[model samples]
Target: MNPKELALKAITDVFVRKDITAFDKYFSKDYKQHNPFIPNGTEALKQFLPTLPKNFKYEPGVITDHGNMVMIHGRYENWNGKNMIAVDIFKIEDGKLVEHWDVMQEEVLPSQSANGNAMFPII
Candidate 1:
């Protein structure tokens, strides 16, 4: 799969579907994570996934690819009792994800925004 497709599938399988096998399929053994809350490596992610609240949900939005990197803008619902908006960036190599980075913030309701702009596009 292309980098974008790989990224989407990886996120869907691991985060949305909670498929542990997806880690071996989509990620390199030495996968590097920039998220401080999670340790480096696919095994660490596998362990982390099951600890999430059962109501946790991931909603992917706009996605873009540049070279071997893919960036997905998404929302995490019921994450630690609050919703979050995040941009997840993945680096693909040899048909697998080698590295990841993310920037996340608590999602604010549209009504709370001074300009009333949504964090994610309204598509």
Candidate 2:
């Protein structure tokens, strides 16, 4: 699959579907994670997944690609009891996701925004 397709599928499988097999299927064995709260490597991610609240949900929005990197804008619900908007970046190598980074913020309601604009664009 292309980098964008692989990234979207990986994110959906791991975060949305909570499918543990996705770690093996889409992640490199030495996957490097830049999310400070999570340890480096796919194995660590596998161990971390189940600890999230059962109501956790991931909703993907816009996706962009450049060379081997893919960036996805999405929302996370019930993440530590707060909704979040995030831009997740993935580096793909050899058809597997080899690294990741993300910038995230607590989601604010549209009514709370001064400009009345959504953090995530309509997809």
Candidate 3:
């Protein structure tokens, strides 16, 4: 697979599926992840994958590849759960993931949650 495909697959198939072996095949042990949540290393991914609700699914809208790096924009949906708009950035080297960052926000309407006329910008 291409670097971009491998990177996304690592997250979707490996991390999201709680398949740690995916990391063994796709991640560097020295991987460093920068997220508002989640720790560093393969173990962080290992621990985090299971935290997501099993019904979750990501609906990708955009995937921009810049050489060894990729940026993904998507909406995460669960049938009866919260809806999330997410943006994730990934850095890959030699078909293995080395760094990752993401921002996930709950979907809210003009008068429902925050963001309707919120002061805090979506960063």
Candidate 4:
């Protein structure tokens, strides 16, 4: 599989399944994740990822590969409970995800939702 496809699969199996050991197989030990709630690094991710409610979806957009680095745009929401559009940047080093950066906002339903704009960067 291509780097992008492999990355997506890793996310699906590791994150969705809450399999911490998957990181060793699919991600680099130096993996760095920047997200709203999480601090940093794979260890932090291992701690935070499992705490989130199940069924959080990752709808990856066109994965643009800059050689080994890939930029992914996706929407992450836990069913009807909460919604957030997330921007995740993945860097593949030696075929494994070595770095990750992400940002997310609470979904804003124009009139009903409390948060302002769920879609960030309006990209």
Candidate 5:
């Protein structure tokens, strides 16, 4: 898969579907994570996945590609009704995701945004 497709599938599997088994297929063995709360490798994710709140949900929005790097924007809806808009960046090498970084913000009302639209991409 190209970088964008690789990122989309990887993110959708792990985040949207909440499946860690997909990790081996999509991630490089040396996968490095930049999420502060998470540890350094794919194995850490395997350990952490189940700890996530079961009610949390991830819905992907737009995906952008930059050669070996891809970024995906999505919504993370938690159990308490609090929602977050997040952008996750992945670096792909040899068709496997090798590194990742992410940024997230709490979802806000349209009035709270300067353009009166949600943070996620409309497309």
Candidate 6:
């Protein structure tokens, strides 16, 4: 699969559809996560997903594909009200996601922005 397709499948299958087994199909065995709080392995994420609140949602907006890597901009709406705007980068090797990095900021409302525009263009 191409990098963008791999990224979409990884997030949509696992986080959106709640299909944990998709990790085995989309992620490499040596997958490395750069997010500090999460451990560095596919197995770690597999173990963590079920622990998330039922209301947690990942809504992807814009995607930038660059050959072997893809960057996704999205919203992570969790049950705790810590909605975040995030940029997730995935590196693909041989059709599998092998490395990941992410940066997130709390989503700002239109009222909070000087220009009154929401952080997510899709919303």
Backbone atom clashes (below 3 Å) for every candidate: 0, 0, 0, 0, 0, 0
Model 3: how far residue 4 lies from native, Å = 1.5
lDDT of each: 0.93, 0.93, 0.73, 0.69, 0.85, 0.87
The runs of at least 3 residues in candidate 6 whose Cα sits more than 4 Å from the true structure, single-residue gaps closed, are none
Name the TM-score of candidate 4. Answer: 0.70
Q: Is candidate 1 or candidate 5 better by TM-score?
A: 1
Could you give the C-alpha RMSD of every candidate to the true structure, in order shown? 1.0, 1.1, 5.0, 4.4, 2.0, 1.5
Write the residue-wise lDDT of candidate 6 on 1-123 in tens digits: 678877998988887887889989998998988999888778878887888788899888899998898999988888256999999999999989999999999888999888898898563
lDDT of 2 by residue, 1-123 (tens): 999999999999999999999999999989998999888887777888899898899999999999999999999999989999999999999999999999999988889998888887664
In model 5, how large is the Cα lDDT of residue 79?
Answer: 27
lDDT of 1 by residue, 27-116 (tens): 999899999988898777778889999989999999999999999999999888999999999999999999999999999888999988
* Displacement of the residue 18 alpha carbon in candidate 4, Å: 2.9
Clashing pairs in 3: none
Expressed as tens digits, the lDDT of each residue in 1-123 for candidate 3 is 887788778767763465778988988888887985667887866776667777877666667898988887767776238777777788888778888888877766557755566212233
TM-score per candidate: 0.95, 0.94, 0.74, 0.70, 0.87, 0.92
Residue-level lDDT tens digits of model 5 in 11-116: 8898778789879999998889899977777887888677778788888898888889898888988824689888889999999999999998888878888889
Clashes of 5: 0
Report the lDDT of model 5 for residue 10: 85
